[model samples]
Target: MLYSIWRYRHFILASIRGDLKGRFARSRLGAFWFILHPLAQSLIFSIVLAEVMRTRMPNIDSQAAYPIYLLSGMAAWGLFSEILTRSIGIFIEQASAMKKIAFPRLCLPVIVWGSALINHVLLLLAIAVIFLFFGHYPGFAWLYLIPGMLLISIMAFGIGVFLGILNVFARDVAQFMTVFLQLWFWFTPIVYLKSVVPEKFQFLIGLNPMTPLVGLYQDALLFNQRPEWMNLWPAIVVGFVAVVVSFMVFRRASPELVDAL
Candidate 1:
């Protein structure tokens, strides 16, 4: 167990370094795109959904502040969705490296999650700037976003690791995940607050671990409130279960993964 963790740690560092290098390998702005991509998405979504469309369901109260609301949710959703989507094909893409390298198979998704995290951090910084410009700087409660971000990453990593390994034997898993993530984005409270959902539907939505995960971010950043412990506990539990199951599956499949490639 200890050895696996150590090996994964080494591979994670190496993968992160490689990711940063590749991310800016040819760009003049270099790492700046990390900030720009999310910011651009937030800007466009905010404008189209909040301004031009003037869209809001019947239940949401803060229609005026919906842009920041949606931005907060989208930031976390984008990270998870991107990692989940990309990690699907990681083993196939790195087939040569996997065949030759002695590193742990688990490291592939971790690396992708780590790189996505860099982008998420940049998005958070941009969110802070946006809030400041809007005259709504987040308070100390915003620190909760650190733990919230960690939870989201763990959730993404667990799912990604499972999918990455599975993709080796079933190429169709990657294609399915792309469409699934698109449907998932809407199911999650990215554009609408959970409060807007009816009480009966709330439990169904809560089944998706992301519902509470985004709630944590919104609580910390947008509302300046502490995370709802009752709401967050389920997502944490789901994430924990995902990690254990993913690790077991990945470990069992690692030897086969190399052969499949």
Candidate 2:
């Protein structure tokens, strides 16, 4: 599958280009809208929550720090959740193409990841600029964003492909994910500080794999601290397993998917 995808590398890039161009084809701002929409959201949310949670961060001493914290987490969560959400409907969206095409089916999820990564790049760039505008430069700690986003993206892609395969067979899987994501968001601590999550309920947050990943982003981007590497290993192991399992599932199910559609 790896070799096959490489064989058609140009096709994948073209598909990504076409997908992006079509997405922005009708809008005046086009791709800028992607960055603006999320930028505006982070700015608005930060303004609202800064006073409430500004002091939660120990490394940063200013109220303006809240959006930096928030957007850092969003940078990670947005890539993850967007890929997962889009994965649910991907097979269905390309059902006709699946039936007719002889290309690798794995490319479908890759396309999703690639597309989300494009948007993620924009968001990260926006976040960096915002940090600069606020006089909060990241320095050396900022480099963590690359590997941090990679690990998160790989893990998210694994979950997405697994869910996508399931959604293909059970249409309800797609519908259920919509509601599942809403609940998942509050649980992940995107807008607020985890320190504010009460001790009694902290165990619930600990059980969430995303908790540590998002924390990694927050520590690196918001506080300019090294990520809690001790806590990150377990999540990395889970991501590896998920990627392996997803590949096995996709390989076994690909031939049958065309029939199902």
Best model per TM-score: 2
Report the poorest 10 consecutive residues by lDDT, candidate 1: 52-61
**Pairs of residues clashing in candidate 1:** none
Q: Candidate 2: RMSD over Cα atoms? A: 1.4
lDDT of 2 at 147: 75
- Candidate 1 residue lDDT tens string, 10-38: 66887788988998998999887877876
Per-residue CA lDDT of model 2 for 1-261, tens digit only, reads: 889989888888998998899999989988888788777888789777778787677666776678877888878888889888887788889999888878998888888889999999987887888888888886788787787888888888898899899998999998998898888889988898888899999998888888889988988887787887878886788789989999999999988998887
| Model 2 regions more than 4 Å off | none
Give the residue spans of candidate 1 off by over 4 A. Answer: 51-64, 198-200
Worst 10 residues of 2 by lDDT: 55-64
lDDT of every model, 2 decimals? 0.80, 0.85
